[model samples]
Target: MVHVYGPHIFHTNDAEVWEYVNGFQRFMPYKNQVKTTSRGHVYSLPINLHTINQFFGKTFRPDEARAFLERQADKSITDPSTFEEQALSLVGRDLYEAFFKGYTEKQWGCSPTKLPASILKRLPVRFNYDDNYFFHKFQGMPENGYTDMVGQILDHPNIEVQLATKYRRSDRLDAIHIFYSGPIDGYFDYEDGRLGYRTLDFERFHFDGDYQGCAVMNYGDASAPYTRVTEHKHFSPWEEHQGSVCYREYSRACGPDDIPYYPIRLVEEKALLAHYVARAEREKGVTFVGRLGTYRYLDMDVTIREALDTARHYLPRAAARGHMPSFLEKAIAC
Candidate 1:
């Protein structure tokens, strides 16, 4: 199954949320084992024992490997502030330059020093040989794909689907409450300023045969113009296909016309984001939810969990014709 945008693997530890989505569509077992092409060699991601041994050309045990990395790490960076420092402290200069430095610069359109350490916190450095990308309890892909599952969820008699309509603050709708999932800045017509975001451009092509032999193959070389190459067929391994559909992903600063993917929460953006959040808190008759509305990078399962929580919180108030709160749980930048 090909993703219209890019590959999204649904993995979460929330059992209730997992059971809830399974009601709509069947999910086949899938684990995302990402690969990175660094210095003309392919390596398993998360910087595990396999990668460590291969890179340094040594047979290291778990404890030995951990100690080796400890030695390699820059002990001087006692208080790591930036992502670069964090990586140097964790994997040392060699691994950081190999796997993180170049790819991060390409993806964010900024140096790793400019990014926060929290951005690199998502990546794990393991001692064991486990190649699984995530540590989540439950991981899988929708059998029929995400589109079909979303369609089933939206196939309600009361719900209406509007196409190609732009939202504005001035437009009034006949509804008791509103859940504004659009951009928090856009809702206010960018009155204060636009928050920074990284938008992805996908150059899609069809291959006569298997492409890259993996779902996601990242390029860690700074020389490479693009970030990664995704082969669609590798995503759904249950279904067999002779040909493959692939995409070369390029990440850049999001413009007014581009579709934003990642929220670039740099110092400048955080200052700008604070203004928008304060403005949203004061507004009434609407609630902000999802990644865009809150200006945070959230996984699908967490998004669904929050959506469910928001709905439960809103229903009683809607029934009694009470005033709706702007946000059930607010996002604050620290």
Candidate 2:
């Protein structure tokens, strides 16, 4: 089966979360070794020691590389205000422009200068040769794929899986509580402007054999139309298929029918989100959850982690007949 929404990698530091998933599905050992095509050559991703050495033509020691980066970094910007400034300060101009600038503009459909510097805080810029993508203890893909895992999860008697069901805000519900994972704006019938989101268009094609030889290959140049190419077969290396399926991913502004992939969360969206969040707080019997619900980009682990926390939160309230808050500490973290 294909991951129609694109590759969902499981990586987390939370021990309980790791154990939680393992109980449902057998996870195969997998490490996402990402590569990026910049200019005429390909380089290792997350801009690590190997990437740095390859890009700059230097085999500097750890301390030497750190010192070199310090020199390259823009020391003038003591307090970075934007994503561009933050990246420039972290990896310096040449690396930032080559690896981040064009790619970021393509991904977000805006100048990084307009994005908050906090955006880059989660991004890892290592002085070591670690290219594992995520620096988490547990990282792997479900042996039978996510669809199967989800099917197993919903196997409980009380849960009835509903597809092709449009959830109308006006619909009268009989449920004691609600956990909404749809777009926050849609929940309120878009009284405020629809929050900006980045949706993906995939150019899916089949290849007889290996395609990119890797799971994900990023295109860093603005000249390229798409952000990355994902070869699905490589994701589950434990099993082998002679054939391959690939997707050249293109990101654009989300529309009414399009699935919201990445929330923009720019100045305009943030203001609208603030209003929607305020409305959600006042909303009864509902708790906004997940990426779309919270209007933020979140990994699968974070989303699941929050969902677990939400359940734990709702249990006590359910027993005591108390009010369950709209946003908990975990939800707020999203």
Candidate 3:
């Protein structure tokens, strides 16, 4: 049985997904404002110039901000081997501690020093006043909702969606080809060991008016139990409502029953993943796709792009080969 997750905020860099979503008539565009709560004050995320200026109480122009950050950056860390080291090298001690250290520890359920440097590499520090969370050229959400957009996408005559259906491995054992988007380790039934994952618990509540006055407000303080609170109404600013809904997100280690959100690819988890990959390589007539299938963290856009690429590669080759093609080329490489 497949249990699909609910409502997701789709943010992508892929032009195809961007164009496809834009084709929808009820699309709404809003500049992303991801704020962080640190030291009882809210600051713009991605460490933009405004955040730096506000945090340090200085009016720094672009060049001045760049120079100021350079001064804050630790020159001693010539080679960063961990996420903490990487943050210290890029931003410095104060900003790193206030914004990254506690939040990261809560999110991953581990010290930043134990995580990979690649985790922090994706975050960009801006020298300008731009507070947009993502710098993607095409950035927006559906005006109506993600549910409505997905319903529109699934309105095809050729496609059939069976909701509340539970799919089991035994049921598809004899199938010629199978495209699996579930956890790769789950496919093998966790023979080696269960791969680590960080899951989230969201506490939903209703507010009479604007609660945090933002779409996303992250709690950077380690003392804070929850990681972030997302105001749902702010996501669709085009629509007006008397009341607002928000979710306070708490990150925790994924249990057997919980839905996995972020893949925890620590040293031990990587070893476990390697074993699963080897097993998948030897398996026949099966291909793994998506973040969980490939055991990697992927954003909405990259996931869609990969899905399109996988289909493009498989459909053409499968017919000519007269057999199911191997797993996704990229997944196999990973």
Candidate 4:
């Protein structure tokens, strides 16, 4: 299969998953420290004390810092409902509007007020100076890049892959069962209304020196069109390069004909997914998997683990039932 998309970072906290990946490629230890253009000052992400102090233009002790934010917060907002409400309740309207509102709008193509609160819940208001982006137990990119690892994974003699072959379910393959990694909605030819999705646009630039100090920089201001820029060379800190490659990521609403990157599975989309799943259950010979196949955003590690689980669990069951093994079976069970 072609990796038409950009880089895929594989990271996980599971030991078994780590071991399995290590069998194919070595991993390098890397951490992400992103910067954001908030109000005008460049500050570390997750909005720690350094960011707060810089934004307000005042220094405060630990206790005073807590009190400073309390004043900014909307005391009247007893129960924060949406992302806007939560932001206003905790950090006041000005800061939230500056750093969050536009970025969220550009990323999801919807106002933060209209989006789910859980999406913005990941942000932190730190009293101390911990600038590390994610708190995950394990984090790193592949030493040899993702394309190489995937090539190695599919190198088994038992497996044969046709790179550009467009498959149809009705095609005659009398003895061979099909393992489909295409969109679920497409598999059924959109019997119902199309599912909603958000696709990304990447703008690449070449630079001589480090264009940005960090690998990622978030444009929090509402005026900026792109959400963030990622420097690929910095992703692999183990090797240094004279030239660096970077990508500015822009988010937009996906059309039915467009390549879907992230499924906007609001209440309506879930109902549609249920429909496709029910239809899949009726068809016994086919199995559907992967991001586009399932119409969901999955991290690389989770995708690999789920793939291995699908193979291991369904193989035995298919043999016992005297039917060809289908990767799609028992997916929901996992």
For each candidate in turn, the TM-score is 0.97, 0.96, 0.93, 0.86
Which regions of candidate 2 deviate over 4 angstroms? 329-334
Off by over 4 Å in 1: none
Order the numbered candidates by TM-score, best leading: 1, 2, 3, 4
Q: Enumerate clash totals for all models, in the order shown.
A: 0, 0, 2, 1
Residue pairs in candidate 2 whose N, alpha carbon or C atoms collide under 3 angstroms? none
Residue 40's C-alpha lDDT in candidate 4?
Answer: 71
lDDT of each: 0.91, 0.88, 0.82, 0.76
Q: Which lDDT tens digits does candidate 4 get at residues 1-334?
A: 1122554555578888988888877877877787898667788878778878878887877788899899999999888878898899888987897788889889888777776565667778888777877666777777887778778988999978777776776763553456677778788887777777898888888899888877789999878899988877878887778887888888899887677887776667778887777787677677788876776667777777878887786678667765644334444322
Q: Rank the candidates by lDDT, best first.
A: 1, 2, 3, 4
Find the 10 residues in a row with the least total lDDT in model 1. Answer: 168-177
Best by lDDT: 1
| lDDT value for model 2 | 0.88
Q: Give the local distance difference test score of model 1.
A: 0.91
Per-residue lDDT of model 2, residues 167-279, tens digit only: 87656377788888888899888976788999999999999999889999999999999999999999999788999999999988889899889888887877788888888
Worst-scoring 10-residue span by lDDT in model 2: 325-334
C-alpha lDDT (0 to 100) for residue 51 of candidate 3:
94
Candidates 3 and 4 compared: the better one by lDDT is 3
Poorest stretch of ten by lDDT in candidate 3 = 1-10
The TM-score, computed over Cα atoms with residue i paired to residue i, of candidate 2 is 0.96
